[model samples]
Target chain A: MSSEVAVSKTGTRLRSPRHMLADSATLGPFLTLLVLFVLFSLFIPKFLSWRSVSGIVNAATPIGIVTIGVTLLMICGEFDLSVGSLVALGGYVFAMLLLAGAPPALAALLAVALPALFGLLNGLLLVWTGIPSFIVTLGTRSIYRGIVWLFSGGTLIQMLERPAVLALFNGRLDVLNELLPKGANFRTSLIWFLLAVLVFQYLLTRTTFGNHIFAAGGNAQAAAAQGVNVSRVKVISFAFSGALAGLTGILLFSQFRTVRVTTGAGMELSAIAAAVVGGTALNGGVGSIWGALIGVLLISMLRTGVILMDIPFIPADNFEAVVGATIVGAAVLNTWLGQGRAKR
Target chain B: MGRTQDHSEPLVRMEAIVKRFGTITALDGVDFEVEYQQVHALLGDNGAGKSTLIKILTGVYPPTEGRIYFEGRHVRFSSPRDARALGIETVYQDLALVDTMSITRNFFLGREIVRRLGPIPWLDMRAMNERTRSALRDIGIEIRAPHEKVGSLSGGERQSIAIGRAVHFGAKLLILDEPTSALSVAETRKVLSYIENAKARGLSVIFITHNVRHVHMVADAYTILRHGRKVGTYYRGELSERDIADLITGERER
Candidate 1:
């Protein structure tokens, strides 16, 4: 029904001073991590080692991918409390495949498929029930973990000689000796991780679907009025989050050489933590993949460093308190920044 | 005060639109129309069905008994998407925008620009920014990058972006619900200017509000409702402010 109206001829686009504040929200966490990295390097001499760096990158792989999906969910203003459960479910299925003599390719496919299906179930339940995601995923979480525990009898699935699948999990593409300083150009899951980030970053920033996601999260009513498929966006977001968690579960199975329901038990909390720490607000419509990565690395390092220091580290509950405080701190910092921007 | 009557063909016609909530009727057999390139103001007191009428037209709440016809076609909307797909765009009072995203991102939400080579495409940030700046400037709001987060914008600027988005999309039918009710006088004037600019572009606009005075400034037709029923549809030249004030608070009848 467009009447073919001409575009604005106004010579300039006026931006409010407050914009600077929200724009800088991601910056604070980014810069803080940067500062922490510098400080940690100075204090812990081995912080800059390639092996150490590679280890961090590798550890961050699974959770980082999950965090990217969570970032999207956050932008769409939803959360997946079921990812940890899905991870457990997917991992078990993958391991079971290996144990049952399934080829590496089929096992990998099933690993991604089963959990993605679980995610779909989560999505369908979420949309059909009209229940809040917190409740829906919460329900699905138990269903998934229960199935895994019930079927597996609470034992880990161990496999022998998973050469193809193991290689897929930890493989690297190498030109051998001709590529720059390093011989290998890629790590398998690491490659997937970068693609996840790049594809997601694009989805969040470039496409109409991405915009619909932000719109739905920003204000569902408004988005609907603008012709966005809000319900579809919600379903897709939840499914995507679940699917990523599933992939992470597959990786966990490969890396651990075992599939235990407990493998993904607490990773959801960490992924959520990483998402929040990276500036994907729990309420949604704001976050970055880079920020989630920084957050994941921060978490992994914090946990690892505590072990290395032999500090008889604080209890999990106490650590949760730190995370809770950090979330509040990030919020306060963001609000203050927002207020400052308004002043400008 | 030629604020609420357009002399041309009606761009939008809603006849006997009746909506109910439980047993209570929200909009009772209301009749309304906006002419081609005219600003029709829908005025009513609180709980007088002003919002119900707006919602129905914008597809938030479909009428239980009535028909909406746009450009002579009978239409029924089950959702806001239905309305927008037919070229109906609404700018709400709060000006829903993501403060975390840039102005361009906000403007183009649900409708984005992409620069792809073959199958892989990237968001053309430069073009989006340039286009957003120009779009806002086109609506007489010039200052802000496409990348500037909307949260930091002034209330008026945010309002302008919302309006700009609607105008940029080139909808023949535009609905504005209480756009200026929350703004300062200067901001209100800025909004009015945009409305006038929209009017100049030949867009049929529905301006909904309880504020009668604002109608004097920009509306071409007035549809006054009291208790969910249409009191009258009067041309700007036909009615005085006191006449409608009495009709709305209930002095004049029929």
Candidate 2:
């Protein structure tokens, strides 16, 4: 509607304090991770040890992987509570396939594919039924966990004697071996986790699909008007969440050589916590993979710190208190960073 | 009306369109047409089947008993994507933009320029940014950076960007659904002028609004609907703003 109305003469657009704060919102998570790392190292000398650092990275791998998908789905304004259940389901699938004489790689692929399929179903149900994703995924969560229990017969699936299958994921990196007298036990899962992060980060920031995701999540009606298949975008996001959970399950299985019925029982909450701590808005359309990476690292470090400190009040088994506290704290900080002065 | 353009074929024509949701009829029978290179206004009150008519034309829904012709060819669009593929773009009042996204991304939301590197198409970020800057500038919307988020922009600025995007993408029929209902007088004028600019560029516009005054300034023809039926189609010079308003509000007996 161009008439005699001139271009906005609002002067040169200066970066306002509001814009700066919004930018800092993303950086907030990374900064918190850095601050926590420094504080931990200062107070707990063990945190500075190469062993502790490696252990933190190793433990962070599966959680980081799960966080990647959860963060992506969250950015698209959907939640997948079933990821924890999917992880357990995947472990059972892998274990069952391996026992059935299937090659480890094939078992692993099927394991990943199963959860991806479930994710697709979750997304389709959400889109087609016009139900809130939280409700749909919440229903699927228990259903998937039940399926896993049925298959496993409520018994632990254990393969304690490590085969080449387990070795592929839990193998140590030779490069870091010379740095530590005990030999660097850097788990291959960490490499896989970081690789997933880099790939997803590229997808979210440097691709057209990534742009569509933000659009769909930010405003579905707007996205639909632009001819972006919002339903497809959401479905794909759910699949990513489910598939990553499966991969994390595989990693967990490889690391411990055991899959309990409750292997990933409360992991969905922890994964969400990690993403929230990394500055991912639960409301959606504003987040980063790098932030989630930092978040998972922070979560792992906190868990490890509590265990190392041996604080009588906060037992190692009760690390969830720290996680719950961090989630609340991070959520508050994120809101503060995003809260700009109201527009006049 | 206004300047005559040789009475060529209309760009879009919907004949006796009737839509029903269950037993309730939204549109009984309505005929609407928009000539090429003219701003056609659709005026109606609430529940006057204006939304139903627009939805049918835009492929959001198919009429229960009606046929739509685009460029004199009968067509049935199952979804909005199909309609968009045929060069029909609708800019809703909300502007259909993701505020959190960069202006460049919003400009090329579904139609992104990608470098065909391997199987995965990587976004041509630099090219897209440059194009968005020039595109918005052509429409008299100047932002400091194309990479700036759309949320930071004012309401009118966002509408301009949406209009610019539709124009750049070669839309044959640009539909504006109450584009000025939420804008200030200045912003409304700016948007109205852009509609005029679009008409000059040979794009047919379906300007849907209850405000007859704004439409009077730009629309070459007016189609007024009342009680899910068309009252009449009047040319610009044939009716005053008051007459059109009465027609929309059903104040004047048929």
Candidate 3:
């Protein structure tokens, strides 16, 4: 036997180009985000102000919170298309409860819990019928959307004008204003989003359930043979997706002070796009919570930049085309990196 | 269901096991047994109920009609989890491993060791890493790192990891399904040594393979099944190479 094939003493293989490419797939979005930030600062007047920066953070939080669950579900090899509907439903329920004299805390709890039931249903149908989650969630998207219409009678619910709810979710961190005056005013939702990111990051990396999610998503039959309850993992992940969507809805409702019937329309796709662009595979078993967060920031930054820029050819509504293109481009790059990984 | 310290009884015994899949009978009246600390090779041609028998024994699927006795106790397993809880582990042909997961994570996939600190039981990564290192070393294979992804390992190394994990978890009976079917010559030799090492450590092994040559070296006893019926059981030296080959091909009847 050749001595070269023996194990290295340090127990770490030298990083090859393939490893570098894989790392690039994860880190590439950060560079894009930075470049967009720089380009917007250079071209757009008032684009470098704290108001603009905080605007981006505030806009990113709702979608960012929802993406955490979407990312975890994707990692566990599932999807929830009903997240947008859940956001609308959550806000509707919260607003309705507040109007009916319910406490803010109780209203918020029911809002999050109600949408989570839909997620549970998505998971249950997938497990019981052995259907693909894509199809299952597609069915659920309309069901939840119908519920949103039925709840609001196809009109925006604006009756609840509670200052306490707004102060809790949409308030700025005024304590920091003493430091820099303008720069220190940060949205409270950013704090919620960051906290969600940290908690989920810990859940995904530091615990046994997180490991099981990867294994269950990666190779379910293998995981089953080893005694992992693959069905339970998928179920819990879907619930997380729904609950986060509810939270995002509550945050958006607080920001706008009204629950629109079309509150979370198409945000589900945006979350998926952000997660994929951040390096999550649609097939599952390969993603990180941190990567998905970067993706959310990148997409938010792109949209913010595109809306602020004075380009005549590209309309504001056509910003979705950029997101679409980013998804295709990232998938291609991921496939390239995947080929390199297989070679090694 | 009595605990008898009878040395003469087999560790696991199956009698008249029958398994039917809709209209087709996969296994019809097959009897199999394995002794304690002995390597028993289950050999048969394709569609000869070799896999069906193993699945029934390991609690993957219940037999349509049969009884299984484990350690002198009549047992019926509802699922593979139940079988594992009883210290019976099966290393499938694919090794049942998540490739993208780290070796330590894969090593303790279902049964994770956690540190109970306040309320949440966090993964004891340091202990898992140390255990994975020593377990692989015990099987004569030194990995680059315990945290290295299992996908980077070669075919034989993956098999070793699965076997080592099963042994470490105190599997009384390790059922290996074609461990050497997809290996190179050198890799096959390495897997054979793993089987031998497993046996030396007082673990009863049910080595299943269609290939007779791979199991003959380390197998102490051989059970040949043809068309869902056992032809006979023989000691290691009782049957010659040609005789075993003929039995596998069902030429003994002619």
Candidate 4:
């Protein structure tokens, strides 16, 4: 009799509207993406074409990859503004190493490791000096970009010789492209992006380290009192952010076959905007990696839709105004949804 | 209760603990002890060094001059983690729980159960959820589900979860800092029962509070501190409620 009562009570709670809303934190962004997709398809001719869809996906790849790290760092209650510069730094390091006759694999490893090291340095400075991460990364962003400028001598480093390994990162997906309609353009970079999303989402949801990340961000003092190494978690998170940014640089170079000092300038704001639109909390400890991916796709779709619409007053070069409005609107909607869930 | 066979040595003993923060002495030559299966109440007014003494015991700070013995062996802690490794758990006044997280997640915050998928470790959420529910139920706290956010629970329920987590994690010494101060009368009664339940399970608890009535209700032995000095340590019935109050306020002679 007692067990029956317990079961029924749990059943009621599981079916509660508040519980349903809490479980659907990512649902709002996903629905918005669908609605926008349908509206764009209805109004704009050729907007639903495979060519156009793949273009949006392809253009979102680099920033999509960067947002993965940015979201993780933000969830841990820290920020890495240096990632934009780190992206260029990564491209320079990879391009220089390859130009010097180094092995492609070795160059790639160092490309990722160097940025990760700088990220670790950022974490060390933040922890040791007790400075806010925003200030620390803000300072490092200039220093890293300066390094990129010095390395490239403020010129573009273009590779005339394309290595076979470059194809592994951003090569055209010939088989999928052949299977799709004419003008379809897909790349291996999208696969890598999706794989990263899966692996990181798994890490954030299914690992002890992931639990520590949430706890450290949610309540640092409480987590420390419970024997969690909050500083180590934060430092490691910073390293991950750097590594991912470096990976983004590799992807960018693979596609363009060139590295410049201004390769990823202003990308930091875009990645942060994507993370916030994906329902990640600015204060930390509440987010989903899947939501981040959706956010990237949503923003890219918006960009494509606005260009297709070609509104009289809004030029293609000024599409950022629309994207900015979407970021704020999505954030406001997420907050309202969160409050509704909490109130219930 | 039968685990109290070894009465010759106390579970924990702090001798001549003098903690000085620059020029201010937070704890001066304070001696305290807790026996097996006993609830020892450490009582004091504001700035009476109760927090300092607890901090030293839990390895948050190193005493300027003192020695601590646990289970008849000398012990020194550089951090709270070291103390926890020795089966010492402290539920702070804030409870050290992440309100945004689920009850099961908060219950297994630091020590999580994981299954290795090759080189990767995956949290065994099903097993953890089951264990969390059973553990809370064992401590007489039945809930709707383990996945409910801890923020939704009442103050009393939250305290129960914290205490239940400590007990489930194999803590030999549980230090609760003002566990009932923020709770209502009914919640206080529930927490007091939880303390009794912990004592019944053979764990030595250090109940730190300012409530003399609460100390009178559950503490097997009580220690009072006034101005960073130990007034006395007395077993139950040795001091009445009025006497404990007077001693706490420095109104009675030691």
Predicted structure with the largest lDDT when compared to the true one: 4
**Superior candidate under DockQ, 2 versus 3:** 3
- Indicate the residue-level lDDT of B28 in model 1: 86
Ranking by DockQ: 3, 4, 2, 1
Please, what are the lDDT tens digits per residue for candidate 3 over residues A112-187?
Answer: 9999988888999999999999999998999899989986899887854557777778777675545554665677
Give the higher-TM-score candidate: 2 or 4. 4
Name the lDDT value of residue A241 in candidate 2. Answer: 88
Interface RMSD of 3: 1.6
Q: All models: lDDT?
A: 0.75, 0.85, 0.85, 0.88
lDDT of 1 by residue, B106-148 (tens): 7877677788879977777788788888987876887635666
Candidate 4: give the clashing pairs.
none
DockQ computed for model 1 against the true two-chain complex using alpha carbons:
0.39
Q: What local lDDT score does residue A336 receive in model 4, on the 0 to 100 scale? A: 73
Docking class of 4: medium
Candidates in order: C-alpha RMSD to true structure:
5.6, 4.2, 3.1, 3.1
Q: What is the DockQ of candidate 3?
A: 0.65
Q: Which regions of candidate 2 fall more than 4 Å away from where they truly are?
A: A1-14, A21-25, A96-101, A180-185, A306-313, A336-344, B1-7, B18-25, B64-67, B237-239, B250-254
Candidate 2 residue-wise lDDT, A214-321, digit = tens:
888888788878778889999998998889999988988887878988989888888899999888888888889998898888899899988988899999989888
